[model samples]
Target: MNSPDVSALEITSSQACRVALRGPELIIEAANKAFVRSAGRDGFLGLPGWEAFPELRGQGYLELLDQVYRTKKPFVGLKMPILFQPSKGAPMEEHVTDFIYRPIEDGSGHVTGVFIESYDRTEWARA
Candidate 1:
């Protein structure tokens, strides 16, 4: 058996890396460009509110989110199916699978927020 490259930086998928605050002030400070796009929204610098992403309700994301929030550890989505809310008049919603969550922190090393990355598996699958 062969091992994989441990030090490889691959952009094989559309990734999302986000960092924000937790608690009553749950503010989504920064989300990578890919997340902004996959989320089908912009200006994610502030608390966009979970309600905005109606698709996430009742999904396993809540559990993963909780872990990230509490532990400030990285969460990952291995071939995770995702649905993006479409804009008004849009024919259908956009879908993506596979993403990663990398936690961010302040200089003091407190549990800050997480960096979200979405990988468009379709691209690689079709290749």
Candidate 2:
């Protein structure tokens, strides 16, 4: 049997609204164009989610990430409030979104990471 190339498994999905968090530390892996717009930051990769958005630590997002990482279960959050800084040393602005945290498994079925898909719902939430 011929082994497939690992790069072939990579997701270059055109979902338009996607973010990838990997490892037990929940490090940011990739933030797509839509995700960058929603997150307000283009450079989150190599930083842990908590480090990127410390404000979310005690806001239940960290715990939720932990749950998904440990339990390997998917989580869906609706109209969740998030504070994002557009740039370093900038003020944090609140945004609302509906998101899903899904587990990514290797070919052997071992959970390896979490994939985040979210839709901005701030305008509707403000109404």
Going through the candidates in order, what is the number of backbone clashes in each?
Answer: 10, 0
> Which candidate ranks first by TM-score, i.e. highest?
2
Give per-residue CA lDDT, model 1, range 1-127, as digits (tens).
Answer: 2212211133223344333434433466545555566556665456544644556666677567667767766777776655556553455554546766555555566655554555667556546
RMSD of each: 7.0, 4.3
Off by over 4 Å in 2: 1-16
Off by over 4 Å in 1: 1-25, 89-94, 123-127
> What Cα-based lDDT does every candidate model obtain?
0.54, 0.73
